[model samples]
Target: MSALTKQSAEEWTQLFDERYKRTAWPYGSAVWGKKEWVCPDLRNESVVSMDEGGSNLFWAERFGRELGMNDLWVKLCGNSHTGSFKDLGMTVLVSVVRQIIADGGTIRAVACASTGDTSASLAAYAAAGGIPAIVLLPRGKVSTAQLLQPIANGALVLALDTDFDGCMAVVQRLSLDEGIYLANSMNSLRLEGQKTVAIEIVQQLDWNVPDVVIIPGGNLGNVSALGAGFEMMASLGLIKKQPQIVVAQAEAANPLFRAYQRDWHFEPIEANPTQASAIQIGNPVSVRKAIRTLERHQGIVEQASESELADAAARADRTGMYNCPHTGVALAALIKLRKRGLIDARSRVVVVSTASGLKFTDFKLGYHEQRLPEVNALHTNAPVELPNDYDSVRRAIDTHSGWNP
Candidate 1:
């Protein structure tokens, strides 16, 4: 129920006042005009798609009109090498970190606490760089695919003896150790990489500005990065207007929403096991930046019900878009905002589907099990069954496939 549509509408004046004194690589006229010495490995484009993301900035007007949204066309970033929108941030981040290390910058190992998506994205990138990842993962919380990512990608995945918070605590300690660099959403480099999504979205849509852009708010870094990207775009005159961003979060872990509502000292959730595991953080590391990103843009964090997440998942399946529960939570918030008149038919909506649905084991698609098939048969889709041991699983596989594993 908390909103910042008014405050965000007027945040640029303050941001403008502060932009003069900043020294970030992405900011300032000097940095913008300078020829970046790090020659991008264009050959890498062979392995990764050289998609036209920024080019969409050119068609903002066309998209806005077609979507029936006034001066607002969504520049989507959810489509990337990794399903979730975190790839853009990670790619740019790896580039910077790689260049620094190449130029005599010293660093030990890269570490992070993953909630399913971020860890997967980070693991793949870290592996590609040949950097041994010290991944701290909470026990039994991450999705199956997320859990296997580091293993499949050849990174050292350590199952922590605790929850996501405990893993983050370990990462925070390592950040100061100088023996490892924290690679969570809190790392500004991740923000830098993430900002490119906005750039690509605007580029792909011919640079027309969307009336509204919605982002999932977890540790706050993702949305904050997006806001900063749009702000940079406006400064570069890439587009005449920028979208007013709206953030979404689960009701169970909505410290930002609660803080915005109470307008007092923030008291984040102590813990949560919400369906939206990607956003189940108790205290967002990017707290201040997340709040300011919203406050500066007149945005709001809408907390959606878990049932809404289920409904949204159903909608996604109906639309032929399969995503994990975290994505469903984002869509749920979108629907909630629309129902509340915070968003309307007049507003063209772009919901970011964060990850592939295959990652989840618990959430169900009616199509997957129309009759709520027995939980015994529920796991039948896994291709192997066991009588409580690997030998049994092997026997079942041999019986089913007439072969050995």
Candidate 2:
């Protein structure tokens, strides 16, 4: 099937109304709420869900004010069951695989190549559906927390001595066999589920569309997924206008950004190590689809330096948000656009935070400690170390609070 189909406005309106009123298990899911829009053929019993989606769209009042934008919002996709946006897609992919197997299909296991979040979400959902999960990961590239998830979920995790691109190649070859079902975003089914992020955003805003939407780009699947969502809504008259989409990338690993700069022509460069490990992709699988979406939306691709991303994450963290490094990359791009008047102060914008900061605790800790290389700790709030003496502790407190000792 194509990325998305255009539905009649009347048909969509009826479906939207039905979705809003649904209070059942799978239908209650924000992703599955628009079941007819996503995939309506699957039986409810075949669905495997942890009631994912319905993440908050928080008004970043302080952060927005700092940027002179009054209507900036952050989509907290990290607040899901698996602590990442991958949960939105994984549930659909695994559920469909289970259904196919239940109908006497010859699939033996579901497999995927992941950086971190995908493996975690895929493992959890596959485990829930009683399906064997096989995950291929770049060895020592993923964080401890991210690697631990698949291990805990009983996935057959293979750590290969290569980058994400290498792992992806191996998985693609393995999935050629009918016995191994592919669970990667290269499969349109996963993109179908991930597109719900865009749908849920409009629903949260009373069906009003924002002026701009910024997302972190990795495998490029999300770029197309988001575009598909808005296109579907526009086709159905659910939204009158389409937002200017932006794909943000870390400077160290920015193949899409390089292509955008050269008028969509470039050879893939070797991806450098970035703190945002999830987006460290040299050759993204969905590049062509992402390019199409970008052209359709007049999209912008921006890169954020290591210091820029780290500083942006640190600054956003101060405003009661523990943003992942990937979010920092997007936030930094938004900041650049706003500064250059590409994104005006009056426009309503939503920046998608892909994963939870908890997954990259070491990255956060290194930044706070002023330890990460090339990252400017613009707002460090390191804890004070005091000796084991009442007087010393009192003096340290007094010094910190500006009290004359």
Candidate 3:
């Protein structure tokens, strides 16, 4: 369902703003875009996000004063049903799954590999939708909030003694299992839902599009899907200009950076070490798509160092953005590119903050700028107001955070 299928512009506009507020959604069976939407076959396969009002405010360039739609406008894909941009994909996938079940399908479960947000979205949805969800989380990777979703939603949460790659291995194995469905990037239905971000972005801009879109690269599905969205938008006459896309990655695992530099195929990486754990992927599932999309639209890939990411994370905190290390990496990359004159200052830039920093509840994005405390003084609750002499401070110290051990 797309704009052309609409009886009037007003009706299409209403559907475009569905994420802006909750109301009786009547466009369930109607086609609103150039693609067929899908959701899990639960009680109703038509459920969608009821976006609060003012998503339009974000769409409008408050960064500008006149309120006129410039050549570009920012789209907060993060405003999806699940809080993170994954909702854009999950909503549609849920609908599709529900619909398939209604048709006497034998689908038994859904599974995915998540750094944090995607697993939560799937768990919450599958739990609410009465579908069994199997979430494979990397060992010692995600935060408590990230890990809580599956347990809270009553899904089978498997703490893989592995990283995202290992979890992905399990997902691929499950996908091969009879009656098991993998919800990872392998499912194309999610992309249909994700395409709405671009569609709505153009609609919000009053149809003005960007010259470039920057994404924090991990599995790289979103970045690749973004290019797909723009191409479809162009075909549907949703936007006027095609934006060159750019990807940001941690220098610790600069596979994309290396690939771009050598003008060769992006080989799988072996080890990626960065504070930006969310985007720490040695082998992204959608690299081919990412490469193809970049070729079609002429995008660039860049890397950001850990120190730079930490500094930017602190800067975001200072500016009230309070982003996670993933976003920090993107911001750092952008700043570096700007300093190097790689990104034109006048070019409209959109950086995707995939997950919130608060998701990490315990871990922090930025590092200490000053010299770190000594081994005996790392406790947060340890007293630092001791006498000037280091010996006096040691003598006056209480137990470590009240831990007798």
lDDT of 2 by residue, 144-247 (tens): 99999999999999999999999999999999998999999999999999999998898888788999999999999998999999998887667889999999
Q: Which stretches of candidate 1 lie over 4 Å from their true place?
A: 1-78, 365-405
Q: Which 10-residue window of candidate 3 scores lowest in summed lDDT? A: 371-380
Residue 215 CA displacement from its true place in model 2, Å: 0.4
Residue by residue across 337-365, what tens digits does model 3's lDDT show? Answer: 77787767567666666666667544352
lDDT per residue (tens digit) for residues 1-405 in model 1: 012223342352334334322444333211121112112231222122122122112223432343344543323344444556666556555545555566676766777887767777777777776566778888888867778877787767888887777889888887897668778878776676566566545544544565677777778888888788788666654567767777888777788878878773478676566767777887888888877777777787778766666656655444445557667677667667766778766765555555667667566533244322211222212334346888877767667842211
Off by over 4 Å in 3: 1-22, 26-81, 365-405
The C-alpha local distance difference test score for the whole of candidate 1 amounts to: 0.61
**What lDDT is reached at residue 83 by model 1?**
54
